[model samples]
Target: MKKIALAFLCFLATDSMAQVSQDSTISAKEEIEIIEKDTLFIDMAKYKLTIPNNWKIKAGCTEEQCTANSPQDTLGGFDTYIESINITVNKLSSSSYTAEKYANFSIGYLPKVVKGFKVLEKKRLNSYSYRVTYTGSKNNIEQTWRQYYHVRSSKVYIITFSAQARKYDHYQPIMEPYLASFKFK
Candidate 1:
């Protein structure tokens, strides 16, 4: 019994010592706060797009936003060869914005954008309320893909992912995971 008690006391002392050592390693210079991943992240709410992780969030047209700094304009003979994510939120009382509306906007912009592009696939997440996904092509040769997600309650949340027709296949896998991670509470 005496030996057992001695061993137990030693184990406790060792455990306490280990904890003290760990506590000491956390210096005052280091931030003590835990940095949690942003679950309610929206790069741009109005555009219904998400800001890619690599892309820094810059001041957008609205108070809540960010945009790619590449300054890409499809009108400049630039083929629509890009991938993008978008998100937006609206009030429950507001008019419903469907995935088709966004697709129409893309169609409208495509004329101003790359000259020959048509939508390919457009999907809406029924579980996510107003979420939508769209894939299209440029001149039937270059394919593009887009995804949109929205929430309807007090406010609507929209999230979109887009890529050029040619690059859609390549970027699909990369963006799909991030798209899957989208959730708002």
Candidate 2:
């Protein structure tokens, strides 16, 4: 009787341990699914790549063309800058440019403060175009603000997130999925 009771107690303990382990695995998988759900989706069914979240949309134009050059106050207290997503479709034949080419193109068009950035990740969406992320400077002057760009379907998305020099550590997790979330309608 004593031997049977002892064996039964051992079995119960082992079963409980196994149940806890399974529960942990399920929880982890669920967490991953939730993160995937948070991804931004662009509705580019019309002809343009859809803009994702955390991005402020505006009309693309030269600073001189824009009437409000200053950042506007918002409820969040972080003023929104006057800039544009600046989509130009059918302008170029096809974006056969390499990741380096795109990075060079960015440095060429952006302000001088953007000394030069390195490509962290690049995802080729199709034969013609690619999405890229890089760490550039906003004038490593005063404070070296970090910037990232996501180019897709002839449209470029630029983001100036923070001034941390460890730009990759800060932006990689957020930028990777954001870039991956892009789909051609």
Candidate 3:
């Protein structure tokens, strides 16, 4: 496993005011922009992923399974990341199953494991690939997830992106390239 932190602070926090007064509204002349950004590129044998600089690499992660997590919010919940991506490499026990089958199996079982699981979209490209987007809640926090499944060289690679429901859209751009970088070795 080899990792590189770009160490590029992409944000230019040029804000004149920290908080807007509840009673006051800014005029059209006022423009405030705040950006929090950084990313790390990690290259592994099976895949190469880019993650936010603030995200911590999970202790359980190895060459077989890799996971990176975003920081918890001010509320301080136990759920690992307000947003996260997990990639797992699974070896086939038998040559009978396709990635489609593995993906569907996971989709079917997800609701039982994650509370309030509701699938919003599902796309099957072929017998070899599948993708799904869903929302679920765990530990009192609602979350949205987009998962991808693909098979190559007799191995099924599953990549999952999870985020707080409120932040999913905001975080999607950041997670996109990371998810797309995965492929079976």
| Candidate 3 C-alpha lDDT tens digits along 52-118 | 5456666545656877766554433455455678878899876777877887788889988789889
Q: Alpha carbon lDDT of residue 73, candidate 2?
A: 23
Q: Please give the TM-score that candidate 2 achieves against the real structure.
A: 0.39
Count steric clashes of candidate 2: 0
- How do the residues 35-152 of candidate 2 rate in per-residue lDDT, one tens digit apiece? 4643222232332222222333333322112111112324235633322223323222356544345545655665444556454555555544555444555534222222334445
Q: Please list the C-alpha lDDT of all candidates, in the order they appear.
A: 0.42, 0.37, 0.64
Across residues 76-166, which tens digit of lDDT does each residue of candidate 1 receive? 3775444455444445543565544544554566655544544555565574443333444445444454545454444544455655555
lDDT, residue 87, model 2: 33
Total backbone collisions, model 3: 0
After superposition, the stretches of candidate 2 with alpha carbons farther than 4 Å from their true spots are: 1-32, 47-90, 93-104, 107-113, 116-126, 139-164
Runs in model 1 lying further than 4 Å from the true structure: 1-53, 61-82, 91-117, 130-143
Instruction: RMSD for all candidates, in order, please.
Output: 18.0, 18.7, 8.1
